[model samples]
Target chain A: MTDAASLSAPEAARRSLVGWLLVLSLPLLMAVMELSVYAVEPRVLSLRNIVNVLDQASYAFVFASAQMMVILTRGFDLSLGTSVSTVSVASALAMTGLVAAGAPDALVVAAGLIAGLGVGALVGLFNGGFVAGLGINPFVVTLGSLNICLGLSTTISGGGPVFNVPDVFSRLFYNGKLMPGVSIPIMIAVLIGLGLYFLLNHTTFGRSLYIIGNNPRAARVAGLPSRRYLMFAYLACSLLAAFGGLMLTARTGSGEPNLGGSLMLESIAAAVIGGVSLQGGVGGVGAVVFGALFVTMLSNSMDLLEVGGYVQQILLGCVIIIAIFLDRLRQTRA
Target chain B: MTHIVDRRGAGAVSQRALRGYARVGFLPTVLIVLVVAMALFVPRFLSVQNVFNVLRSSSYLVILSAGQMLVLIVGGFDLSVGAVVPLASVVSAMTMVWAGGAVPGQTGLIIALGVLAGLGSGLLVGLLNGLCVAFLKVSAFIVTLGSMSIATGMALLLTNGIPVYGMPKAFVSGFGRGLWFQLPTAVYLAALVVAAVWFIQNFTKMGRYLYAIGGNLHAATVSGVRTKTYLVLAYAVCSILAAVTGLALTAEIGSGQAVINGQLTLESIAAAVIAGVSLKGGVGRVEMVTLAALFLLILTNAMDLLRIDPRIQTIFLGLIVVLAVAIEEMGKRRTPVD
Candidate 1:
């Protein structure tokens, strides 16, 4: 691990400058989007729409952060979207089952939350056990787990939406606000971002992940518990995904088997666009926030422009490619 | 290489032969066991009609897996193949309809135009994927993932989320459902593709180059192999085969739908890997992949016969994929370097 203090003053300053630029790029892009959309449709610039974009971006923020953790350890979790679906379905079923059994609202919510998080943790264990413990490729393991989760979700939900949660659940979790104009989801996203930032930058486990991702051979030679750290990374990733799914379940007031439509790709797109390298050992919470915001704003702006869903999807695909291309260019130049 | 030569003694040779059999016969052995068990337990499992049904359904998978094997051999796997299927189907179907309407009776010309358009669309996507992955140095996974989204969007946009109907009756019947012998037309098509792929893998310089590239890319580059061009070719061929499967499937179903064959990409990869195609690349056999496809189809067919829940079947499929890969990993660990 190269510490910032070891670098010369100019080098440190230049690095910080680059970091600031990367962090600023998304807001800069969002500003440009605002200007362009204003020229086309001025109504989209209203505070209500801005808040709507932020609210939607909250989900992306959480999902992107989850993806970032695994990518930091040089792993890909293709199962994230399906895991979210499973969590949604599992938690929803648990809650609904509890509700039918005459459980109190708080107990129902707590059990549902625990069930969702538990499913997420189990998926993480499955993936981590294969990839970290058994030395299988993360791609194949996660792909297998994706299918398993999809199947499990559909089976548990009976291939339909699980509905009829207690009204109070959504009221306190998703709809409630900490202050005026600040929804619970937005607050949760912010808290998660801060927690992840602190953990990644200040903790031994987080620092060890970076080291392992940078050079697994070296990390192993240095006697770091690389496998355990990798396992925790995947666990954290899936837990965050489950948390996002729980928020979504609250908002929708249902457990949706198909809840994760296109989110797996979008989460990766968000992280990648936020300067998170797929090769790993780089990126941060700031990048993830900006990336999530940018993706949300782009979609929101396109929606305001009345672009069709299919066309928006096409544009998003293009965005992913272009982001990766630019990242490659940056890598080569650096 | 030296180990095999040094182990020329009678006992050593038999041991080596047994190990080789275990390596090469894993899929076939499982397939045989599955067939025997299904036949013994399931009613009508051994019926000729059921066997043909399995073969007919597996023909498309076999074709797709043949292409997937090539890409895997060349050190990349495509997630976009599934999207390419629907995109090709929609484009081809729409082209045939439009051309038929314009010409007012030229069936042959219309079919030609439709096939060309569908293949052209596939080629374009393949080119995009190849260019990005080979020239721009993007990860094949991300590139294909993006292309998958793009192709899917294009398919949906072209059809407005509706299935394209009105394909020529002759087009659907002659190529899609027509049987030369007792087998479905698709079975013949799949066989032809398998033969073509086998020829490419066994007899062509491109095949050897692909293996070399996959086995050790740096070594291949050092040895003057044109890695970039071959990589593009591999991807192009893979997508083109997927397009072929798409066209055939459209013919069979008599419509072009955006959502059709959504599972082909993963299933094809699964088939190839289960047949011993290494995800790490530079391995696999066409015959084995075909057998693996057949095995999967039979497994599904048998489960359906036994009235197993489709959801449980899906879970079984996932477990099989993971188990196959895990077994391969264990086998690799047990084997010493030659």
Candidate 2:
């Protein structure tokens, strides 16, 4: 007789090994491709180049990771892009107008980060209150929040970008190598990635998100506070999204109303491609990180090759479809 | 006194029936209220010219929602409809502009090509969605979500991200610009589509089958309704409707716009939901959905006239959609599980 339990452990380990291999393979391939394609400037493959890629990817990484939470729960927060936009705009306004009032650069940077965090928490509270408290569908609630967040951002900037923040704020993030060659942004990405990995893999709350995603009633029946965990997940997503917003502001030295226009879908596509199931409860931090890396590399490569902008979008779309198709096939086979 | 009690009890039962009917019919009333209110508040909002423009503008969404309502009624959803809208638009535009000439004065030929392209794309996407959902036992949400990206990517790939134009003006422009009995022809077409949908939903055997499937899938299966086939047909019809909407939109806009703007997805679902279509499925009416579309048009028109910020307008619409759905869900009594 075949025993189901006997195969479970081996099957899970195999899945994990396969998942890790799949996640790392694309970025590794891209690294090789980048080195070869830009061989004339072989230094382009140096540690500094790695730092630049990380800097470019950190904001996407954070936002995509946060969105992975929602996707894990078999829901999504399209409003996240707008949340980042809103927080950045709010932070910019605070740093430029109230907190700094032309104060020192360090003070301005500190104020911006704080404001971003605060706005993120507030947005999370609103989302959680409606979704968890009122029992509204996650899609509808987040869709409403997307509009509301965009409106808030517009109200702050009068529907335009807030430009010309102090250069020192940028220098803190955009400048300074954490090591001999690796930049501060790369350091930040590594730290955040590790933090997320621990949170999702080690913590009870993280596991609860999976439980709730796969079977909410079952979780509830098991005496798990599904609502509370859901709320926490939204809070984490909001906080991370805000952090991404802050990084974006620092990188650009400005806050723009439409900066997040393409972000919502891109993060979603990245998460899905990275093996984060839209039905939720089946992906990991590592998978999403790889997904973001893959997408960023794809776009960067297309740009480097001077592929027309439109074709790149189509290509990205195809990649997303293929990834999801593969994911579905894997699920069915497993 | 006894007789009076009997009459009062009968009255209460009738009132209950009316209230149930009102739940389904409330959206039309709201649409009327919005129109009347706009007429009173905004001077230009009620003008014949503005009415025609709004109706023309709303035609594509109305048709799209009508198609989507069928799928929703049959216990399914189609995220690919918005993707198909733009995809079809591009194909139709490209066919007229790049591929071949619609023979001069053979206006029928151009329209037919455009319609065929639209329907074909919709049919293909819908069939894929149905097959995945039914045969493979894949979740409808995931299947449609994947298809959405796939269809959208196909459009961008096909057009290379540039808008296609230079269509034979006769096919798109004349109907797009001309009026029928003092209203845009598009408006009449929209009305015709809505009426047809109403007839199908209210009068057909397929409609009953859909409601049954939505109400209880297992029961429908047990009853030997060939549930999967009907489900596929439902999606096919929905996609065909979406195609019509796409073509109408292309005609209205006079070209293909590949960027979907995410608004159509929200608005189509919003219109269906506000019309009392339950997300859990097996409920709603075509007339109500048409009214829901008109209602949104009036609300949007009002906001524009009031000079409300575009972001605020979107928020307001989103809020209304959420509230409408929440109210519907709240009114419903939960069914007992087996």
Candidate 3:
């Protein structure tokens, strides 16, 4: 809706300033939270606590990034949480089965990763094909897939956690560090975030995706391969989610059929709070990172303050509503 | 009658009937086939007890789907209905307990107060959702999603993550698990809701305005329709009916839990859509949606009878929804102009 070509230089400057302010608001919120927590207990603001919060935010960052890609192209993936669960179960099963057969550690890990990513890719392909090729509603398609994935995960795991994964797999992927005080999850999340930032800001595919989301008809008229781009968006989203699931498996040292509970909603919340437009064609990786961090920190601070989980849920709902209200104001002004 | 018969012959009359069936859509045909197949294959599938059991179990879903149909007709979604069910149950159960203790031996007063409290909770949620979607101009999905979370939180808070016990014995047995005229009491309640919704959808000015609004908001606004009021009314009615379902379920289950009927939100939407309710708005029927809900119930019931795994049953449900929507899409493409 904000046409770049039609805006005057001064108006554009003002709009960009507002956008920057919105992005900065996440960190600003984080600071406010820090102050409040410090007021309650200064010891909670230690450097160690900050690192722990970041560690907690690692999964949020990954899931939010994955969600941001699909949202950028004007699609929703309600199946992300279930898909992650499926992937976790699949990969864990593969590693455990291979290990039981006396396979080497490297082979077991490779097989697990491949099985997990492969399942993710298949789910993505199904979603993309229905939404892009058949033109079905994204919500319905993803909703259906969400159920299917949940069923598959539960069925394969027989309604329990899959265990006995190779220890080396977790060590190399989740626990190992290039240096002390830096976790593998944090590194993976950062690498994915930076990779997406570059891809979104510096590539023709990314620009075309923006144009397509902004106005699909115009993109088609201008000869953009909108279908392929949309398909790739869903595929990439599921793949990223799958990678995150693999990391979760490594962290927990097992395949949890219920892994990433409520993650679909949380990731969407993070992306939306970080300034990603649900209507699409607006947002950045930087905004989403801060958004994920802000959400993680809010929960962490609440835990420190001994807030009930129910209250946290209520506050989260309120925060999402407020964030969207602000987003509407920004849009109208722009 | 003779003249009509002479003019249209037998073939023409059958053709007209076939056309009417087409207009009603393929759901009925599918339902019939599924029913016949199950009756033939599954033992005891046609017994009176099993038939009544299916109807009893599907009553809640039927009511919820009728409510969902109202919202779909207005081009909106209410994901919060699932959360509202539990919230209503918890609030009502808690109220009943407190009131019963306050007024010892006043069973009637306690039940009435509980029902009122339950409906009030639903109304509050509905009002918030409707106001946000109508006045604030927020997307219905996001507003309902937020309310869903809020409502779930409220339910959990009220019950402290535990089920509320101590419901009046008479209330639970006479209403929740009662039989009336050889059918479950819930069936009568479900029928009353269906009839009420059907009447509103067909014979009310507000319903017509809602249809006009959903069909084309700009045109309806130009034609002097109060689009906002009708939209809110639709959402409110939807939530109230969901609340009714919650009350019935609470009585049946004999407790108020935080997570009762979590799947109803998705299931209700699926039933409406599968019954040929247009998500794009301005189209749906109460009878068809009720029938669709029954069909879904029967499908699950049959699967259970066949000793199928519950997980596989979930997969079947998901596949059926997608397949139905895909078929509808193909049908639309074939008829391009419409």
Say which candidate scores most in DockQ.
1
Whichever of 1 and 2 has more DockQ, that candidate is 1
Per-residue CA lDDT of model 3 for B1-338, tens digit only, reads 24435766788698557556667877888999999999898768998999988999899999999988898888888989999999999999999999989998999999999999999999998988888878887767778888899999999998898999988998899999989888999999999999988888789998788788878888998999988888888899999998999999999999987898567899999899888888878888999999999999999999988999999998889889888888877866664242
Please give the distance, in angstroms, between residue B222's alpha carbon in candidate 1 and its true position after superposition: 2.9
What does chain B score (TM) in every candidate?
A: 0.95, 0.90, 0.94
The model with the greater TM-score, 1 or 2, is 1
lDDT of 3 by residue, A253-325 (tens): 9999999678898888888887787787887788688789888988888888888999988887777777677
**Residues B1-338 of candidate 1: C-alpha lDDT, one tens digit per residue:** 56666866888888788778766857778888988998888869988788778888999999888988888987787989999999999999999999989996899999999999999988988988988988999878778888998999999999998999998998898888777777789998999999988898899999899999889988999999999999999899989999999999999899988988567888998898888888778888899999989988988998899998998788888878888878878877777655
Cα lDDT for residue B216, candidate 1? 91
CAPRI classification of candidate 2: acceptable
Model 3 segments more than 4 A misplaced: A3-8, A14-25, B1-21, B336-338
TM-scores, each model vs. reference: 0.95, 0.87, 0.94
Candidate 2 error regions (>4 Å)? A1-52, B1-11, B14-18, B74-76, B98-102, B128-165, B212-232, B259-262, B333-338
Q: All candidates: CA RMSD in angstroms?
A: 2.4, 4.5, 3.1
lDDT of 2 at B241: 78
Q: What is the DockQ score of candidate 2, to 2 decimals?
A: 0.35
User: What is the fnat of candidate 3?
Assistant: 0.51
Q: Model 1: clashing residue pairs?
A: none
- Which is superior by lDDT, 1 or 2? 1
